[model samples]
Target chain A: MNETQAETQTEIALDVPWNVVVHNDPVNLMSYVTMVFRRVFGFSKEKAEQHMMEVHQKGRSVVWSGGRERAELYVQQLHGYLLLATMERAI
Target chain B: MNIERDAEGGFIFSDVEASLAAMFRAIPSAADPEGSKAALDRLFPDPAAGKEAGLSAEWADYVRPELREGFENASTTVEADLEPLNAGEDGWTIPRDHIDAWLNTLNQARLVLASRYEVDEADMNRTAPYPPESERTLAVSQIHVYGLLQECLLQNLE
Candidate 1:
């Protein structure tokens, strides 16, 4: 591939936005969910609690948005914490 | 169960029931990917949210194996940490790095409990008192206990 072609590919990859979402479930405790959000996203307690509350009240929350690779990693980490997480191309 | 961060840079857990320790140890064995399908679904759900059927299938195909492997590794690490505890007497000290495994394992156990009891968002109020004769009494009680343990771990980390 030409240098310009590679650069264009990289730029497109960087521009693609994927959202990492966590959905509310009956089983996960609020505190535990908040902690997972903080641990995975480095969200402060207040920010984490805010997202947690959103999940609780609204049934889901978009916890993070970024490149597809990072979104996949975050969703995987959330699964490891047993939180319902998914990544999708951001609309 | 009570958990406190130790001077040695890990966390120590006390007041744990023997059965609870056994339960922690059993997580790796009990979390059979094939056998515990319902519980696993709750733990590692499909990410697609039904928006695009093809995308959800593709995502599951890409992510399921990794998620399964992750659950196995986390459960084993947590079991190893809890293996030495004598339950009622000896406390278990979780090394700092393995704390995530502990937290994940506890969360998985709660998922199993929730699955068993058919627990839903309405059932998660920690403050609600369970009816003594309710069939859900035992499972509900256990869920609260695990929640307390998880809270202790989270609080100490903060």
Candidate 2:
């Protein structure tokens, strides 16, 4: 509740990694999904293709895991491209 | 699949597939095919139109003959019943099937562009600090793609 405590909490929270996950949707094509992963995360073609396959077979995949702020931004960007995307804390 | 260094020593695609893929993802689907085709015409306007004469050659590439023709065709195919409604007026409703169809088309275009340009998805994200003109084109293309999605959603509501 004090300023020092609040500041400490903020720093701690900022250090936690958040996970960015893209959910499989019937609407988006596999190729488009792969391209989005490449474009948004700068993933290599092979890596992007792997993730795309995971999404297709597994129904979803955690594409990126990083700071919450960055994760949120990635999720938003993916959504902007009409991908079904979300973010959550990595367990 | 070959990468070369640009004048600044940064990476550049020998093939344009990645950039093309990005653009394709940003195009709207043809719904009510005729209406979509018409809308595209109004947006892109003319074929064989040149980019402003003085612009750099790279910038000029953004304005292509196919762009005008594609828009015209897209506009005609999109549904006209979904035209933008005024404030306080009820908007058109989009059907779930239509949304799915549009998304499918967007995905197909993405594939075509990527294959045509021979750029992988990861390469697209890795390209940092895009030139201003290229960035502008991507932004504009995204807006158009989103607009089509919005239109589909509106139509389904009607």
Candidate 3:
């Protein structure tokens, strides 16, 4: 590939957003998951419950999306709450 | 067993019968996920979900230990809170300060029990009683009871 085209591709890869996803688990209480989302993300009650319900119904939900480092940090906090969470490239 | 709220917003589990007390006392042990690989995996899941091996390994090396330590600390707090029940008292009082620990430890125990038994969503949703015929059945009961306790704490905190 051309030099500029390669650089553009490299920049795209470097700038790719990461998503913090929470997967549903029967063992974890729905209320508890909502609480974690609220606490970790400072999400409002309505917003937190919305995402919690999404995870519960859909098996998983991207709870947060941002820089890879921040996504990793959010995943770490969700894990601290014992929720099944992971960070992945948005693409 | 009767659960009530104290003036300080803590839980007061009074008249806890022997059977329930035994269950409560077992919390610390049940919370330990060391023996079962599945339980350990549940407690310390990969942060990158296998997509990034290096990130997952770094998490295991550095972050997993912190998570384990946090779980252990929560269990310790719960164990200390159960002293009254441990000392032959009919009931136990969870001080307001230790509410979060109790919640965390109870959740940990439930997760461990569920993992050890290979419990799934259908099992959790089962309405009929598990025929108490094996250790696996007993683990199911433990998970339900611990789940109830966690629910109580969450409701009270609301």
Q: Write the per-residue lDDT of candidate 1 for residues A35-86, one digit (tens) a residue.
A: 7788899999999999999998999999988887688678777877788887
lDDT of 3 by residue, B72-125 (tens): 999999998889889999998998889888888999999999998899999999
Chain A TM-scores, candidates in order: 0.84, 0.86, 0.88
Runs in model 1 with CA error above 4 Å? A1-16, B1-4, B14-34, B86-90, B126-136
Worst 10 residues of 2 chain A by lDDT: A23-32
lDDT (Cα atoms) of all candidates against the true structure: 0.75, 0.49, 0.90
fnat, candidate 1? 0.95
Model 1: how far is A40 from its true place, Å?
Answer: 2.9
- Compared with the real two-chain complex, what DockQ does model 3 have? 0.87
Candidate 1, B27: how far from true, in Å? 4.8
- The TM-scores, one per candidate, come to 0.77, 0.40, 0.94
User: Model 3 chain B: which ten-residue window has the lowest total lDDT?
Assistant: B129-138
Worst 10 residues of 1 chain B by lDDT: B24-33
Give per-residue CA lDDT, model 1, range B3-103, as digits (tens): 67778668887877676775555555544445566776776687766875875687678777787777778888876776667344556778989877777
Stretches off by above 4 angstroms in model 2 are B1-158
Q: Relative to the unseen true structure, what is the Cα RMSD of model 2?
A: 21.3
Residues A1-72, candidate 3, lDDT per residue (tens digit)? 999999999999879999999999999998999899999999999999999999999999998898887888
Where does model 1 sit among the CAPRI classes?
Answer: medium
